[model samples]
Target: MMTQNLLVELLVEELPPKSLKQLGQSFAQLLAASLEAQGLMNQNAVVTAFATPRRLAVHIGNVAAQAADKAITQKLMPVKVGLDAQRQATPPLLKKLASLGADASVVPQLKRELDGKTETLFWDSIATGTSLTDGLQKALQETITQLPISKVMTYQLADGWQSVNFVRPVHALVALHGADIVPINILGLQAGRETQGHRFAAKVNPIALHNADSYAQQLSTEGAVIASFAERRAEITRQLTSAASQEQLTLIDDDALLDEVTALVEHPNVLIGKFDAAFLQVPQECLILTMKANQKYFPLLDAQGKLANKFLLVSNIRPIDPAQVIAGNERVVRSRLADAKFFFDQDRKKTLASRVPELDKVVYHNKLGSQGLRMHYVRAIAKMIGEQLGGDALANQAYEAATLAKADLLTDMVGEFPELQGIMGRYYAQHEGLDDDIALAIEDHYKPRFAGDELPCKPIGVCVALADKLATLVDMFNIGEFPTGDKDPFALRRHALGIIRILLEKKLPLKLDELIQQAIKIINDDAILQQWENSSNSSEGIAVRRMALTLTNHAYIAEEVPVLHKKLQEFIYERLAGSLREQGYTAQEVDAVLGLDPPLPLILKDILKRLVAVRAFAILPEAISLAAANKRVGNILKKAKTEGFDNLSLEELSLHLRSDPQEPAEQKLYNALIDISDITNTALSTDDYVTFLQAQAALKLPIDDFFDYVMVNVEDKVLRNRRLTLLANLHSLMNRIADLSKLAT
Candidate 1:
C-alpha cells in the first residue's frame, strides 16, 4: 500500500452565498467519510475544505492509493442442502457457488460448520481492494447525491440532449493524488489539473495546479483567490477592524452577515463608504437592518453606540484607486436608506391605536381567527397577569400595550421589514405621547426572541411578554400544532422556554399552572367565542366558528382543558429540565428536584433553590445512605398500599404503636424521627431547603437498622399496619424538599 495527499475540486457558477458554507463543509465531509469507510483513507487523515464563490474543493492527507485487501468468511447453505446423500454437489449449491464466481472444483475445499442447530458450509476467500480511481468515483457520486441542497437547478450540459441537476451549473472537475491526475468523471466533466479562480482578477485565466500540496498556494498567488472559507473570513474581519479603528467607530457584530459576505467574495477588500448623515434620523435599528439585509454592508456605530454615517463593504476586487468603488457602494446604500426613511415618515402619519382595525384583515391563523381576535385574547391574559402582579394600575397599562402590540404589523415600516414589528410599535407609541411604560411594553413584549436573548426590562413589559407567549403556546397546542421531535414549525418550544426564562429570571411570584389556566380560560370564554362568530363569514371566521363551537361545548371543554393544562405543564417542565441540565446540573439532581407530587410547589423561582440544595446535599458523607433508605421506605410503603393498607394514616401512627417499642430497631427509628421533625419543619417554614435536607442525616443510621431488623410484612396484622404507618411518616418527611429516592443510584 502506498499513501499520498489528494485534492478534489468542482468548479461551478457562483454558488448561493447563504448556503455556501454548509455546502463546502458537507462536500468535504461526505467525500472523506466515504473514502475512510472503504479503507482508502486513515481516520486521522487531515482534511481541509475550500469554498469560494465559484468553487468547492478539498485536500486530504495520507489517503491510500488502494484499500488494503481483506479476508472474509461467508456462510453458505446447510450441508444437507448443498450436498446430496453421496456428498456430491447439487444444482442449487452449484448455482450458489457460480454466483460467488466459484466452480464445482472448489466444492470439496468448503469447510463444514454448525450454524444454529444445523451443519452449514462456509466459504473463505480474499477480497481485492478498490483502486483510488474507482473509490474516488463512487465517493464523488455519493457526495453530490447527499449534498444539503434545498433546491436544485436542472440545466442541459454541453451535449444538447443531456441534462443534469445540481445546486449550480458544473463547469470543471479536478482530482489529484500527489502529482498525478486521478481519472474520474462527474456531472459531464472530466478530472483535470486546471480550475478558474477570482473570475476577473486572476493573473492567469485558468491556473494549472501543480500537485495536491500546491493547489492552495498556486491559487492564492496566481489566481488571486483565498481558497479557505475561514481564512477568508478572518481576513475580512481584520480589514474591517483596521478600517473601523482608523475612524474611531465600531462595526456592528453579526456573524451571519459576516459569513454570507465571506461566501460572496474570493478576494475581500474592505472599503469604507458613507451616506448622508440626515439618513441617521431614522431609528438606528431600521437603518442598520436596511444596510445589512438589503446591501450586505456592515454598519459602524459611534462612541455612544449610535449609527454612524460610514459603513464597511466587502468587495470582490481591489483596484489601484479605491475611490470609485467606495462611491459606487455609497450610492447604492443611499438609495436603500432613502426608501427606509420614506417608509418611516409615511408610517408615523397615523398612531398605533389607529392601526388596530387593520389587524382584522390580517389572519393570525385560520383556526384562531384574525390578528384582531388574538389581540383580544392576549389583552385579556395580560390584564389578568397584571392584576395578579401589580393590581389595577399595571393591569390597565398591560391591556393598552397588548392592544397596540400587533398594531405594528400593519405599519408601512413593519410591512416592509417584518423583523421590526414590535420595534416600530414602540416608536409609534412614543410619538403618540403614550406613557413610557406602555411604549416600552409594546416593544419588549417580543423580547427574548431567541436563546440567551434579554428579557423585558420593566414590570409592564414582563406582564405583556408572558401574556403574548402564553396566548400563542396555548392556542397552538389547542389546535394540535405542538412540536414533534425536531419539527417545531410553531416554535412552541421557544415560546415555552421564553416563558420559563422570564418567570425564573425575573423571580415573578406567578405560578406556571396558574398562567396556563388563565390563558386557556381567556381563549375559551363565551364572549370571545361569540365575538369570533359575529366578526365575519370569511374562511378565517368559519374556522374560528368551528373552534369556538369546540370551546363552548361544555362537555368538550371540560374534558379537554384539563388534559391541555397537564400537557402544557409537562411541556414547560421538560424545557426547564433540559435547561437545568445544560446549566451543569446532573440528570439525577434534576430528576430528584422535579419528581415531587403535583400538589407540591412547582414555582419556577424556587426550582433553582431546590436544585442548588440538592447539589449541596449530594456531596455530604451521609447523602448516599440517606437516599437509599428513602428509596427503600418508598418501596415498602407502596407495597403496603397494594396489600390493602391504602388508608393507613400517620395521625393513627401513635395509636398503633405500643407504649414501648415492640422491637429495639423500631424504637430507635421512632425516636430519630421525633428529634428531626421540628427541626425540618422550622427549616422548611423559612425556605431553608438545604437545612431541611441536611437534617435527614440524623435518621440514616436508625433507618438502616430498622430495615435490617424489623419485618414490615410481618404475619401479625396489627404489627404490619403499625410498621406501615411509621414508614409512611418517614416517606412524607424525607420527600418534603425533593424525592430523595430519585437520587439513589
Candidate 2:
C-alpha cells in the first residue's frame, strides 16, 4: 500500500499567537489541497495542525508514499509544420519524434481528406513516480513563503550573506515521516524531526524530537504544551466551567475573545483570580474589555448574571507560583480599567451633545475635513434615509443622534479605546438626556461591523448608520481615497456592504443611486465648498476634494451619471451576482442576463433568481436552439425593426424577402419572434422573470424545425435575407428571457 505519515513543525521567534493558529490551519489546508490536486491521496489521509506562540506544527497521517505515475498523452498534430504543396510532413521530423520516445504514424487525416493529404502525430506519456516528500516539500516551500505578510523584515544572518524575510525570524523547521526524515526547507530552515515547545515551560532546550509520536509525548510531559488549539480550547472550557461551578459563577461566553484566548495558550490551565471589589464601580463593559482584550481573560458573572468581580485567565503553563501570575495579570488588567474609568468620568462631566462642537478639531481624514463635518453630512443623509423608510420620527431622532454620535469620538473614552467607539457614544448620549431613539442610534451605527454581524433593526439607527457610512464614502470620493485591494483604510467597502446588507435585509424601497446622490450633495454643498476654499492650507485641500469626488463618481460606469451611477450599479450587480452564485447560478448565466438588462440592483436580483429557477426546468435544449436561431438571423435584420403588429406582416415580410419564400417556415419563425417580444415586455412590466423564461423556451420546437427544414443561406438572396431577419428577430426577443446566448447546452 506504501502508506506513510509526515510531521512538520515551523519554529519562529515568538510569532503573534493570534495569527499563528490561523496560519497553521490555512497552511495545512493549502498543503492538503495541493496533494489532492496532484492526484496523490490515501483513502484515510488526514491532516492536522497545532500552534503555540513560538511554533506551528502540522501532522499528516495515512498518506501515499508516491503520487501515481503520469499517463501517455496522444498528440494528434503532425510532427512537421509544412512540406510540399501536397501539405505532407517531412520524414526527418517524424524520425526526430521517434528519437524522443514518441510513437508516430502517417495516415489519412480523420477530419480532412485529400490527394496525398497525410500527417504524422507523435505522442509520449511519461510516467512520473514522484514521492510524497518531494511534492510536500515543494508545495510547502512555495505556499508558506508566499504568505501575505503585513509586517515583516529580511535578516542577514551572522555567518551567511543569505537574507531571509519572515513576520518573525525563523529559528528551526522539523519534517519527519515516522522516524525517517522528510527533507524540506522553507524560510531558510531545513525541516527535520525536532520541534520546540512552550517558551515558559521549557525555556532553553524544550524540543528533543526522535519521532512524531515521541515528540508529541515530550511536548505534553516536559513542556506542558499540547500544540493543538482545539484541544487547548476544549480543555480550557471544560476546566473553566468546572471551576466556575465551584465558585457559583457563570463564565461569560465571548467567542471572539475565546479565539484570542485560545491563541495565547498552548496547554490551557483555567484559573480564577479576584480584583478589588471597588473596581466594580467602573462600567461593566469597561471591566470586561480590560480583562478580555487586555489580559486575555474570560470574565465571570455571579448567580444573578452580573459581573462577579472575578475573572478567569487561561494560562499556557501551570506556573510554579500560580498566585504570582494571577497577581501580574490582575495588576495589568486594573491599570486598563483605571484608565477607562478616568476617561468615563471626564467624558460624563459634560453632556454628549456638548462634545459635538469639539469634533471639528479632530480631522476625520486630513483630506476629508473634520469629524464634525462628517457628522453634519451624516445628519442630513440619515434624515433623508429615514424619510424614505417611512420612519420620519425615527429618522429625525437618528439624525439628531448622528450629529452627537461623533461627539463621543472627541471624548477621552473613545481616544483610549477605539473599539468602544459606538459603545461610548450610546452611554454618553443617554447620560446627556438624549431621546431613546437618539441614544440607540449612537450605538447601532456600527451594527454590521463585519459580514456576519447583524444589521441595525431600529429604523432610526439604520438611517443614521447608512448616513454615517455614505458620508464617509462621499468624502473619500471627494478626497480621492478609495479602497484598493486590501487597503480600505476608511473601510469604504464595509460601508458599501453595510448599505447593501441593510437594503436587502430590511427590504427598503430606497434607490441606491438616490441615496448615494444625497450624500454627494451633502459633501459638495456650498457651505463645505466655502469652508474648503477658505482653508489657508497651501496643499490645495478643496481642489483635492473636487478631484476625489470626480474619481469616486467614476467608480461606476452608468448611462446617466456615469461614475457614481455606475458604481452603484456595479456594487449592486456584484452583490446580486454573488448572491445568485450562492444560490447555484453559474457565473456565465448571471453575467449574460446582467449584460442584456439595465443595471438595476433589484432587477438584477430578480433576473438572477429567474435564471437559477430556470436551470431546474428541462428547457436547456430549447434555450440553446432558440439562441442559435436568433444569432443566425441577427445580421439579416440588423438594420430592421418591427414596424407594427397592427399592420399585416405576411405580405410585408415577403416584400422584405427578395429571394424565394417558403411559406410555413417563415411564418413559424415570425410567430415565435412575435410571441417572444410579448413575453419580454410582459416580464418588464410585471417583473415575473420565472414565467417569462419558460414562455421564451417554448420556441425550442419551432426553432429546431425552422433550422432543420429551412435553408437560411438560400440561393435566392432576397429569401435568404428575409430568413436571416426573422431569425435575428427571434434572437433579439430571446434575450429578454435572460441572455439565452450565455446558456450553452
Candidate 3:
C-alpha cells in the first residue's frame, strides 16, 4: 500500500509557438486524467504542467504503483435459461464461464439476481489493478494521440526507415516514478531519466532528473530553463515592466503576444531597442502592428499613450555584452518598419478615393458581386442609418466613409498584413485630407471586432460600422449562408453581435426590423441586384452583364429577405439575451424581459432597461403570487383560445367581459382589472416596467378570490367565453412588460 510521485516529459524540436501552451496543457491534463481513470492516480493528486520551446512535461503526486483491485459483478443469463430443469450446469452456462477463464466447478458459486421479471445469474470477480508501467504507457499513448496539433510533421527516426508523425520531431521521452524510471516508449523513443536542456545556456548537459518532485527545480538550476509556461510568462512580464519603468514608458500589453513569446523562449531576456524616430511618421498603429506581429517586440508608449521610438525585445539568450543583441533586434526591426513606411508612402501616391474603382476586381462573395457592389450597398445603408440617427451632414460623411472603407483592401500594406485593412484605410484617408470623421470612421468601422473590444468612437464611425455589418448579414443570409452550429464561415455571428452591441451601447433609436429591411432593400436595388446576378458570369478582365433584370428576376434576394429578416431579428435577440446572461443576469430574468416582445423601440438599451426593471420586480413581495396568478391566467386563456373560443384582439377581448353581479368574485375582479388596466397602459407607454408591475399588486387579491370561488369553465357557453375574456384581459395587463408566466415556479 505505497504511493509515489510521477514525472513525464517529451523532448521535441522547437514546437509551434502559438500551439505550445495548448499542447502542453492538454498533454498534462489528459495524461493525468487517463491515469486517474485507470485508478493509478487519485482524484486529489497534485498535477503541474511544464512547457518550453522544445518540451512538454508533467509532474503528478500521489500516483499508486498499481491501481487497487476492483470488485466487479457481471450479469450472465437468466437462471432458467442457463440451467436445466434440475438446475444442473447447461452447455451455454459452461461455455460462458469458460470464456471468462472459469470452469464448471465454479458454477455453484454464481450469484442470483433479479433483472426485471427474470431471475438472472451473475459472476462476481476481482479485476486485477493495472501496474504503473502499463497504466503510464497507455495514458502516454492516449495523451500523444489527442494533442491539439494543428498540423503534424512526418520524419524518420534514427533508423531512417520508419516514420512517425507529431507536432515536431521527437527527440526523447522521459518517465519517472518516484526516483525510478518507468519503462515506456512513445514516438519511437524509450522513456528514460535523461532530457535535453537549454540549447546554449544549460549548466549541465543532458540534464538527468533525480526524482519526480525535483523536476522543475532541477530543470531550472541545471538546464537554465524556466519550464513552467505560467512562471516563464510571469518572469517575462516582470522583466518587461521593470525595463519599461526605467525608461519612463509603457509596454503595450497583449496576452496573445505574451503567450507566443513564452512559447518561443526557454529563458527570456528583456532588452530595450529603438527604431528611427521617422518611422513614427507612419501611423503608430502600423509601426506597432509590424513590430509586434512580425518581430514579437512590445512597443513602448509615451505618457500620452502614443507609440514611442523605443521598444522592448524578449530575447531567448542573455549575452555578456547585450549591446550586440539589442543592435541586432534594432537592425531587423528597422527593415520591417521601412517596409511598412514604404507601403504607407506608396499607398498615399494614389488616394483612397482613387482606389475605390479598383475594388471591382475583388470579389466579396461568389453570390454577392464585388467589393464595389458591397460598398455601394454599404453606402446606401449608411446613409439610411445616418439620416435616421442624424441628418444630411452625418449621412454625407457616412456615405463617404463607406465608399472608401474597402479601398484599403487593394493597398500593399493591407495586402501584406490583412489585419491592417481598416487601419491602413484610416491613414490613407488622413493623407487624402478628408474630414477627421471620415478618416476615423474608415478605421473604426471594424471596431468591437471581438468580445470586450471598443465600438466606433464617433457618430460617423457608428453609422458606417452598423451599415457594413448589416449589409454583410443581409447579403450572406440571403444566399442561404446562415450560420449552422459553429460554422460561421462568413462571421455572421460576429457581425450580428457587433450590430447588437452598437445598437444597445450607442443607444440608437432606430428600429431593428426597420434597419434590417433597409439593408435588404439596398441589396434588392436594380443596380446592385443585377450586378450580383451577372457577377459570376464574367471571366478575368471581362465585363459581366445581365439583361437589366428587375427586382423580381433575382429570386434569391426577393425570396430570402422576409424569411431572413425574421431570422435575423430572432438571432439578434438571442445574441442579446446571451450577452446579458454573460453580464450576470439570470435566465428567468432574461426570459421575463424578452418574453414581453416589446415592439419598435426594440433598441438594445431599451431591452436592457426592461431586463433590469424585471430583475428588480422579481424581488418584490407580491412577485411570486402575481407571477403564479399570471401563469394561471395565461394557461386558462390559451386553452380556451385553442378550444375555439371567440379569440378577440386585446381591445375586443376586454369589451366582452362585463362586471356582472351574478358572480360576485368575477365582478370584484372585473372592477380591479379596470383600475389596473389604466395604470398598466400609462406605465407601458412611458417604458416604466417596474411601475406597471407594481400597479398589478392591487389585482392579486381580487384575482386570488376570483380563482378560489369561481370556475372559469362554467357549463354556459356564453359565461365561459365571458370568463375567458376576463382572464385574457388580466393576462394582457400582467404581460405588458414581460410574460410573467415564464417566471412562474
**Tens digits of per-residue lDDT for model 2, 1-745:** 5766777777877776667667778767777667666655654577887777777777777666788788665544443442334755456545555665443343332223222555545344566866877887776766676655567888876468789777778888887777777777777777776666666676436466777656667787766787787887787788989998989989988877777777777777888788878878766777787677677888899877789888888887786779888888888877877887788888899887677666666666665556666676678788878777766776677678777777777778777778888888888777777777777888889878997898886888888888887777765654456577778777777777787777767767776766776676665675755663564342354454445545555432232234554564465457656765786777867766665644343422255355654574325556666556555544344443342112224456646543434666667766776666676677658867666667767777777778678876666655655665566556655665555555554
Kindly indicate the candidate among 1 and 2 with the higher TM-score.
1
Clashing pairs in 1: none
Taking the tens digit of each residue's C-alpha lDDT, what string does model 1 give over 1-745?
7899999999999999999999999999999999999999999999999999999999999999999999989888999999999999999999999999998998988999999999999999888899999999999999999999999999999978899999999999999999999999999999999999787899997988999999999999999999999999999999999999999999889999999999999999999999999998999899999999999999999999999999999999999999999988889998999999999999999988887877777888766678887888899999999999999999999998999999989888987899998898888888889998898999999989999999999999999999999988888877777798899988889999999999999999888988898788888776765665576444465466456548544312657788888888899889999999999999999899888864464788998999989988898899999999888888877777777874457556655555646888998887899899899989989999999999988988898999889988989787887888788888898898889988999
Question: Model 1: residues >4 Å from true position, as ranges?
Answer: 531-545, 548-556, 646-652, 655-660
Model 1 residue 602 lDDT?
A: 76
Worst 10 residues of 1 by lDDT: 547-556
lDDT of candidate 3 over 137-203, digit per residue (tens): 9999998888888898999999989999998998988899999999999889998999978899999
Query: Candidates' TM-scores?
Result: 0.96, 0.70, 0.93
Candidate 2 residue 502 C-alpha distance from true site, Å: 1.6
lDDT score of residue 485 within candidate 3: 92
Predicted structure 3: lDDT: 0.85
Candidate 2 residue 479 Cα shift, in angstroms, is: 5.0
Clash counts for the predictions, in order? 0, 18, 0
lDDT of 2 at 738: 58
Worst 10 residues of 2 by lDDT: 106-115
On TM-score, the stronger of 2 and 3 is: 3
